[model samples]
Target chain A: GAGVSQSPSNKVTEKGKDVELRCDPISGHTALYWYRQRLGQGLEFLIYFQGNSAPDKSGLPSDRFSAERTGESVSTLTIQRTQQEDSAVYLCASSPRGGTGANSPLHFGNGTRLTVT
Target chain B: AQSVAQPEDQVNVAEGNPLTVKCTYSVSGNPYLFWYVQYPNRGLQFLLKYITGDNLVKGSYGFEAEFNKSQTSFHLKKPSALVSDSALYFCAVTSGNTPLVFGKGTRLSVIA
Candidate 1:
């Protein structure tokens, strides 16, 4: 894809139900990231993946939230049991490279608006 | 640790007036600063960044940001405001191998 792609632009689920959000990063991008944005709030980092190394799960809000990325391709964010507080827009972004000094600009997807009822 | 602060929740300006959005950051080492804009029902679009070199960095859509090391500020500026420029603006910062940290977004409304 020319840009980052996310599946199911919108999802509404009942409390306690599990939900999975998928992201397809841009081809050749080695770094992928997931973020959550609450209504009228700033983005909150959820997880990050760089190449084949272990993902950085430091930002995951709770154990119920986990993500997996296969190599440098598709990634999935799964919320074990949804709650009303879990309602937010889940965004995916990709960058060509990853590191501190790297000047890799992130390209974002349209994001999935998750609503937990 | 890295963090970003966008003090103002909203900014209003006339179409022809100049516009500015304030941002401040905290990082251990040299900071990588970025500005992104979000439109209604659309994804975030990159505006500009400051890594090194000149303090004044130019970016897309005739937008520019000044990296002030002393004040820990990277303020976004535009010569003239346009109605089309009205959107949600975000300031982000990162250092070393840490993940990007973003501040609460600021809403810019340019009245035409």
Candidate 2:
């Protein structure tokens, strides 16, 4: 794809339901990231995947928020037993190189807006 | 821990006038700073980055950012403003190989 792509641009789920968001990064990009954006807050880092290495789950807000990536391609973010506070935009970004180094800017997807009712 | 700050929640500028969006960051080691823009119903687009050397770095769409290590600031600037440039701007920072930490976005509104 010419740019990063995400599925179901908007989602509204009931509280306590599980929701999954998908992300397809640009071809050949080795690094991917997930972030959460609240109604009026900044983008909050959720998780990061670099190649086959263990993903950096340090940013996950809680155990309910989990993500998985296959190889260096598609990735999915799952929020189990979603709560009203989980309502936010889930963003996915990919870069040709890892987070470090110059000239490696992240290309982002339009993001999935998750709303918990 | 690494963090970035975009002080102004909104900035208003007239078309054809120079514009600036302020940013500041804090990190342990050498800071790698970045700027990104988000348009309505669109994803964030990378503007520029500052890694090392030349304090002034040029980026897409005729945008530029200056890295000030002493003040720990990386402010985005444009020689002229365009109404189309109105969007949400974000500043981010990363140290070593950590995930990028972003700041609360600043909304830029350029009046025609």
Docking quality (DockQ) for each candidate: 0.69, 0.69
lDDT of each: 0.92, 0.92
* Per-residue C-alpha lDDT of model 2 across residues A1-117, encoded as one tens digit per residue: 589999889999999999999999999999999999998899999999999999999999999999999999999999999999999999999988655423588989999999999
Model 1 over residues A1-117: C-alpha lDDT tens digits? 478999999999999999999999999988999999999899999999999888889989999999999999999999988999999999999988764314887889999999999
Please give, as one word, the docking class of candidate 2: medium
Q: What is the C-alpha interface RMSD of model 2?
A: 1.8
TM-score of each: 0.98, 0.97
For residues B1-28, what per-residue lDDT tens digits would candidate 1 score against the true structure?
A: 8889999999999999999999999999
Residues B1-112, candidate 2, lDDT per residue (tens digit)?
8999899999999999999999999999888889999999889988898888999999999999999988999999999999999999999998868888999999999999
Native contacts retained by model 2, as a fraction?
0.70
